[model samples]
Target: MRFEIIGNIINIETIAVGSSIREVERLRKTYGSGRWRKLKGTGTIQLDDGTICEAELHWYEAHGIGKKEIKIKFILSE
Candidate 1:
């Protein structure tokens, strides 16, 4: 859930954005009383020294694809 980004962003792409009218209205009071949207991004996480052997980074605004549901992706240098 917490980590340090030790490199500059080389390249990134937005994967998708999901929203539902019924779900948004149902949880409006909790998530906020407006149109609710979740985002997803993916890219290569590289070291500051410009190494090519980097890990694949996936970012999500909500929900999850890994251990924790974090909005930001942190890349640690080798």
Candidate 2:
């Protein structure tokens, strides 16, 4: 879903890294290579419908490629 992070993400943690990431190959092909990591964090987000909620977010990132394919794993609160 389309949304914007309202503030900083907290409790950030790496779920996977490099070759361990299931989508590493696709990530590299689409975004170029670096050190890809799959990470998750909790933060407040404003959805396209204008609903604000707390959510868990997951995405892939590399040193210079930045965050990619961010998705909400689930909503924590409304």
Candidate 3:
């Protein structure tokens, strides 16, 4: 799993792996039209070990039909 946030740019990647999550909040400041897609938000991730972390999430994707790539970014863990 990887998370990074630089100003308006954000990136995050994660897999189920050994860690398990119970709940996820929501995202804000989201905007996208009929073309490019973009969104920004914050959420909480709980691990199987009961470790709680706060994260900022972001996603971006181009309009198409095949093999779309999604980029996510998380930051500030507690």
Best by lDDT: 2
Q: For candidate 1, what is the lDDT?
A: 0.41
* Candidate 1: tens digits of C-alpha lDDT, residues 1-78: 333344553455545444533344444444444433443333344344555433445543333322123344443333
Q: Name the runs in model 3 displaced over 4 angstroms.
A: 2-34, 47-50, 61-72
Off by over 4 Å in 2: none
* Cα misplacement distance, residue 40 of candidate 3 (Å): 1.0
Candidate 2 per-residue lDDT over residues 1-78, each given as its tens digit: 799999999999999989999888988899998999999999999999999999999989899889898899999999
Candidate of highest TM-score: 2
For candidate 1, the TM-score is 0.33
Candidate 3 TM-score, true structure as reference: 0.34
- Put down candidate 3 lDDT per residue, 1-78, tens digits, no spaces: 543333433343433211131111111123322233344556665545666666666544334421123333544677
lDDT of each: 0.41, 0.94, 0.40
**Candidate 1 ranges with C-alpha deviation above 4 Å:** 1-3, 20-53, 62-78
Q: Give the CA lDDT, 0 to 100, for residue 55 in model 3.
A: 66
**Candidate 2 vs candidate 3, TM-score winner:** 2
lDDT of 2: 0.94
| Full-model lDDT, candidate 3 | 0.40
